[model samples]
Target: MKMASFSSYYGSLFLLSLFSSFITIALGGTFNTDFDNLFGEERVDIKDDGNSMTLTMDEYSGSGIVSKNEYLYGRFDMKIKLVPGNSAGTVTAYYLSSIGSQHDEIDIEFLGNLTGDPYLLSTNVYADGIGGREVQFYLWFDPTEDYHTYSIDWNPDRIIILVDNIPIRVMLNRQSIGVPFPTKRPMRVYTTLWNGDSWATRWGEVKLDLSNAPFVAGFKNFNANACIAKQGTSCKGFNGGKNKGLDIESKRKLQKILSKWVVYDYCADLRRYAHDGLPYECRKENLLQFE
Candidate 1:
């Protein structure tokens, strides 16, 4: 019995060390309590000593907020609880964007669903103002019931989108292969609750139900462990330092989600891009990396 106890104690220590290794390699971030109102001030509310905020969308207008600083690359996180019930036409979006005719962007848009339907999470990346890369998925959990962490890890090498720290989608940097990657510009984090009725639900088949008006979404715990553009190119304390690709465990989880929950991938739609052929990064080897 004594030997068994000793074994168990050492095993616990081993596990703790393993976890600490992961944490130590990444940069730490603090929760942001404030943001600049992008629009519809009356429809936005900040509470809990700026620790939390909510955005509302009514017939008159919707609301948005933008981070105070622009970041070039890093891990950005937001905990959000989506609008509830019959929210078919609304879209709650959290993304990063730079301004200009030729800009770069990374998006995480939640397309609202009917009372019992699942929400659709759509992700896309735009480089140099041209964007057609889109991949959509259905989450494993009911997003409206509670806050869930949605995160984006962007670096020079790749872009990873995660739900509760599990990567659901990843777009690797293929600039070498002639694929446009968002690398040069700096982006400000933005979150908004707005109506996208014309194409948000069933390709616009389902319009907004204003009867359930004043649709709202909750947000809190914003963290940006990034290289602020005003600072320098080197992100000294950014999480996912040095643009590491997925570790073995992360790759496994990504493969599982892609196989089970992915609803749409622009790369696989032959009809849409038959003339263009598949995108440069859509080759078999790239997809096999996670598998």
Candidate 2:
């Protein structure tokens, strides 16, 4: 397939404008305190007056929040501003996960970095209690500078991760190859700011600097429309409808981003797959076949 030039990708900025408008309508209204809910108070502080909410993490403890309801499959989007400055050893994570020992999960973790270095954006998937499919990337812009939209679009067929409307990663369902896809269980959207000093930065090479304690991450526009799953009942399908998938133009934009910004991809990591070969989708040369 022919790749898209950087100029072509830049020319398509209007699509992002359209996406932002669509999201505003889909989300219903501006973020307010009524939507602000907390899970852990001691570590998680909530100042929901009527607008957006901010979460902070310190040496003493970290904080997190969960959606009030669970979802099966659909699009989840959030505008987040990550922790700024010497945030080495900290992690700002957002993902979906089901309960139990054999639960399924999709992760988007921002691994903190030292000043002047880029944060490592890590993505992973877990199925039936097994997980190791890890991919990492460096974003095109400074995430801590401003809030950017990050989205996860999940369906039975595939999973797509988007940053500012540009596709960064795509994970196809490989159930045909005896691989497990997240279909049966319903998951709740969760976000957390934590101290992962042991392994968050360069595999622990950079330790957390407590002097920059109480790191803060801001969140807003938590807009998600999907099928709600209730306990003791079968999950309802996405009756509300699925989000738009990548079109040829969008794929072109993604190609440009990946070529210039992506630092690591599990599909191309020979060291990780040396012992057992690449995953089914990777070997099959699916959408994530950049390398």
Candidate 3:
């Protein structure tokens, strides 16, 4: 009886420890307030003691910022409220990017719209300066009405983008098939409010109505649970290899969002890439087939 009881007690303790390990890996990293003005210094406002930031865009200039540290891999989250009414021709972009002519980038750009129209969310990935993997969506909720949590879960295996914690799109690592993934370079978080008037709204059909000038966007709760590039080449934990990939629940949410809200998926557009065969990422079933 004593032996059995001891075994049972130790078994329960072991199970508890295992569960706690997973939870720790899932939690976010530090709240990152390390950012500096990238451009239009006068138009950017930092409040809440640097925890929150707001960008203003007027006829004269727009504003932007960049993180002080660069990260190799991990999850990044920010709560943002997009430009309000009649935001046509304006774009509020939050993304991660590296420098140089052939740079790497992961984008989350809000293409403005007229009042009553949903803002178009454009996402793209660039590896070694070769981009064009564009996947666009129309969010189910009114982004301008309230702040929404946007996140990017990036690692060596995949890149998963989430809105309000729900996965919207995912790009898998397909380097074995000659597809480039943004693993070699480290990127810094960046946000910009600028005039993309020529092609932002309805492919330029709608111009920036300066009458509704002085567009503004709000940002707060910036978090970075990532492996800072400055901290040596190897590190363990979630920012490193601890994050294997999305679990079953996240994959299910990704599928639902892709089917319902996705307005444009480059993978399915035959006309755009008639010259070359479909990108290797699209040809493989593993890209979207979660089950």
Give the CA lDDT, 0 to 100, for residue 119 in model 3: 96
lDDT ranking of the models = 1, 3, 2
TM-score of 3: 0.86
Q: Of the candidates numbered 2 and 3, which has the greater lDDT value? A: 3
TM-score of 2: 0.81
What do the candidate models score in CA lDDT, each in turn?
A: 0.85, 0.77, 0.84
Give model 2's clash tally.
0
Worst-scoring 10-residue span by lDDT in model 1: 22-31
lDDT of 3 by residue, 122-227 (tens): 9999999999999999999999889999998888877888899898877878788788999878898899999999999999999999989899999988887776
Model 3 lDDT on a 0 to 1 scale: 0.84
Lowest-scoring 10 consecutive residues by lDDT in candidate 3?
23-32
Model 1, 1-291: lDDT tens digits are 999999999999998686544332224432244368899887888877677889999989999988777777788889999999999999999999999999999999999989999999999999999898999999999999999999998877778899999999888777877788988787888999999999999999999999999899999888777766653244433444554778889888988998999999998988987897877688676553532
- Model 2: weakest 10-residue lDDT segment is 22-31
Give the per-residue Cα lDDT of candidate 2 at 241. Answer: 41
Q: By TM-score, who's the top model here?
A: 3
Clashing pairs in 1: none
TM-score of each: 0.85, 0.81, 0.86
Off by over 4 Å in 2: 1-43, 48-50, 231-236, 239-244, 284-291
Number of backbone collisions per candidate, in order?
0, 0, 0
